[model samples]
Target: MRRVQRVPLDEAARQYLCERQQYARRLLAEDRLRAARFWKDMRETAVFTPVLTALEQMAGPRRRCMYCLDSRGSDVEHFRPKASYPHRMCSWRNLLLCCSDCGRKKGDRFPLDDQGLPLLLDPSADEPWEHLDFDPETGNLTPRFDPTGASSPRGEETVRMLELDQREELALGYQTTYKRLKRELEVALSAGPLDPSALRERLEEADDHGLLPWCLRYGGSTLAPFSTLRQEHPAVWAALSEAV
Candidate 1:
């Protein structure tokens, strides 16, 4: 998954959320809160609608799921399950946009490390490429392995929890996006040295699944067309990388 750029909510919405969070925290402290029911009721209110809109804006034009980036982000997901962390129930950073499938699969299951840190990747907060690696051949995401051959525990847990490597449709969508990105580079390279700005624009437009960062900066950089560009024209490669 690509890193999501979190957008700020309006002052009114932020105040509303803060007030609601205080209410939740109070009830939770008293052991009187039913997290699911409380959130469900608040979700239908006018005040909460703005939060969803802001999340959609963060997901970009396609409104893709923050986790998979494939389906429309229809649900406002709690990064830390509200039932478990009621104090963060209405915190802006604790919310994310997710597809119905992912929402269902993830439910309220949140795993944590020994120190009580989240084992899952927070796309808005974490750099995905640092933990997750793309496999162009299978179009499946795997935990990134370090030079020491140790895989990222967070990435492994995230993939397993979200079933990132098992979804056939998700894999296909990633493959299609990868191919499109590859083609853009191939076409640019074939046309002989072209303006880096134009090429960067084309690549960004074609990067529907947000694979440009992976293709341009990470593992995909070592693959064909991209590697060729880097080798043959280091200056253009630097420009393209800087732009993306």
Candidate 2:
């Protein structure tokens, strides 16, 4: 998963969500809220359309799942499980775009660190590469090892909860995108430097799985083509890195 900037809901949508959340809060306080039923009722109505629309917009043109970045994000997922945190049921900050597979895997299973902070990496809120590492050969995602050789707890939980290392199709998609990114850089390096703007655009177009930051800033930067680019064209490398 990659870090994504959260798109703010427009005034009208924002107000609607606030009002609905207030209503949910009231229900929860009165002990009358049934999490599934309440969300289902709201979900089927025209009032919830804007929330879904904003999530799709946040997911970009392909509307890929915020968790896996592989399949179409067709479901509205709650960052905190609605059953456990009913007060946040309609809160704008709680919703996420999710695919069927991810939704199924993550069904209401929210893990938190000892201090109550979330253990699952929220792509919109966290830089995934800080906690997660990608394996190019195996096409799997694993917890990032720190300088002390300890794996990231959040990454470990995220990968386990979402089955990131076990899914064949997801691995294939990541590998495909990684290969495409490598090819683009290799071709650009061989043909002599292109304008930084043009190189950035080309790389962005090829980065379907949101792997650019990993390729440019994380461990992949130490790899062959990227390291070559960094040495041979410091200006171009710096520009592309800053853009991502």
lDDT of 1 by residue, 21-79 (tens): 89988888798899889999999999888899999899998999999998999999999
| Every model's TM-score | 0.97, 0.97
Point out the worst 10-residue segment of candidate 1 by lDDT. Answer: 208-217
TM-score of 2: 0.97
Q: Which pairs clash (backbone N, Cα, C closer than 3 Å) in model 1? A: none
Top candidate, metric TM-score = 2
In model 2, the runs with Cα more than 4 Å from the true position are none
